[model samples]
Target chain A: MKITIQVMVPPYSYEDLDTAIKIAEAALDKGHEVTIFLFSDSVLAVNKLVKPVKADRNIPEKLSQLIKEKGLRVEICGICMDYRGVNTDMIIEGSNPSGLPELAELIYTSDRFINLMA
Target chain B: MEKKVLFVAYQSPVGSVWPNEVFRTAFGMYGEDIEPAVLFLDEACVTVSKNTKPELLGLFPLTTCHRLIKRYGTPVYVVKEDLERYNVKEMEEIFNPQILSRVELSDFLHQFDLVIFM
Candidate 1:
């Protein structure tokens, strides 16, 4: 089954990003296709430069590893990245920059589309 | 077949984008044979109050909320105690919601096949 997860909140503010990662990990482990679209403040979750000073888990590395090892398709919203001043140079290697239109297309075709927004 | 879907809104309108989008989605959810319901709990009870003016905050107008109930014929529910705590009096002409006590609200929640919280 095709499942698309949209995360629209920053990691520090809440658990939205964490929950999205866990859900995506479980879905991939179960052999289902998982696609994650990060939008709004969530675009920060893929910034390779920003590291959590206190948190044990490195979110960006975890996401990059998910893409590389688990075959998770991660996309960050272009508009959101611009608003957050994130460029391709700062984004994690595996995730691609995308737009809402592509996210909408994914949602239209996916069997389940879950939006986790703040 | 029609499925029972309940949208539980706990965020106050105009405080952020979430409540506004949730209601907008609820408005769009109504059509065909779909059974949709809305439950405003906690701070969200203020959105249905006769006094809220979300437009003044440069957000979705509170009047559009009236249209949501009138156009969709969606049953709107709010916790009576919550409204009391927020000091928002439930006016049927304005809010068009059925007042539900805590226990009644819990039972009402169990009837829905899907319950989405915002």
Candidate 2:
């Protein structure tokens, strides 16, 4: 199954991001294709400049690593990023800019769509 | 074949963005291969009351959503358990929303190809 998740909250603000990652990892482990669509504050999770202490878990870095190692596809909302002043240079290297059309396409194509928000 | 896609709204619509965002996404799927619907479950049934006004909470009026739901023929649903909790047995008949029990809802959910919820 192809699973697409739409995340609307920022990382670390709540358990949404972490839980999304766990679900994606579990799905991937089961040989399912997973893609995450970051919108609203969730676009912040793709920022490469998110630095945390050596002891703390860096959520954005974890997402970036997943994109590299686990083939997790992350697409940040273009308008949401623009509104938040998030440029391509600031986001995870593998993440791409997308729009509502892409989100609709993701919804239409995916076997499962998970929306993580308040 | 039309793909059944459900957007589950679990928050009260007064000032929260989840219900608005969920409905907006479901409505945005105009002229698509997807059949998008919005379900008001959990605390979201607070917005299902006939007299509730989102504008009173400084949010946009839901009349616009009602208009879109009518025009696009999008399905809107509120949970029976939640309605009982809020003592709101009489909801606006704008779309004549389907009221399903928790168990019936679980069974109905299986009919969808995708279910989006936080």
Candidate 3:
């Protein structure tokens, strides 16, 4: 199945990002196609400036690696990123800024969609 | 192409207009071509509980969107973890919404064509 996941929850507190990563990885492991869109507070998950402290694995780093290794496509919400004062410089590698129109188009074209929220 | 769209509501359902706005936009955009399902997670689960009274808000109402979506036969799933945190697990006893677990959520992800988070 072709899966497109939207993440809209807080990046750190909840396991939404972890879940997205796991799902994406599992989907690929199972030979399924996957795509992810980060929106709302979840866009913060892709902020490269936010690094994990001692004893915590950096999610953004892990996601970026996964994107490269798996050839995953990620679209972060432009409006949410702007409202949150997140710039392209802070975005994790391989992720791009995107808008609602792109999101709408993604929703229209995908074969399967999942929203992983807080 | 006809696809299934999953709407993930991660924000509080009553305190803000985000959830309602998302629903309106998704409904307007997808129309009858896509099957839309609303899943409430974290604080967002409050929108579906029977005890929630948005009438006090006096603006758009709290459960108005929930009611509107249900009228279209949209299935709303509440994350069990969130419901437990809010001490609103009893909502299932009243409203009978599908309580989703991590595994169930992962399974649901596979069933949809697209998942949009709001």
Most TM-score-accurate candidate: 2
**Model 3 pairs in collision:** A111-B113, A112-B112, A112-B113, A112-B114, A113-B113, A113-B114, A113-B115, A114-B115
Candidate 1: tens digits of C-alpha lDDT, residues B34-55: 4667888888888777767778
- Which structure is stronger by TM-score: 2 or 3? 2
Error of 2 at B19 (Å): 1.1
User: In order, what DockQ does each candidate have?
Assistant: 0.09, 0.36, 0.20
In DockQ terms, which candidate is top? 2
Q: For each candidate, what is the lDDT?
A: 0.77, 0.83, 0.75
Q: Alpha carbon lDDT of residue B31, candidate 3?
A: 40
Instruction: Give per-residue CA lDDT, model 2, range A3-100, as digits (tens).
Output: 99878888877788898999998888898999999988889988889877888889888888888989899988898899899999898789999877
- Writing each residue's lDDT as its tens digit, candidate 3 over B1-118 gives 5667776767876777566656664554444456667788788888767777667777566455655655665677887888878878446333347878756888887797656666
| Residue B72 displacement in candidate 2 (angstroms) | 0.9
Using lDDT, give the best candidate's number: 2
In CAPRI terms, where does candidate 3 land? Answer: incorrect
Ranking by lDDT: 2, 1, 3
Interface RMSD of each candidate, angstroms, one decimal: 6.4, 2.5, 4.0
Candidate 2, B1-118: lDDT as tens digits: 7888888888878867777777777876765688888898888887667887888767778888788777887888888888888788668888678888888986888988878774
Name the better of 1 and 3 by lDDT. 1
Sorting all predicted structures by TM-score, with the top scorer first, yields 2, 1, 3
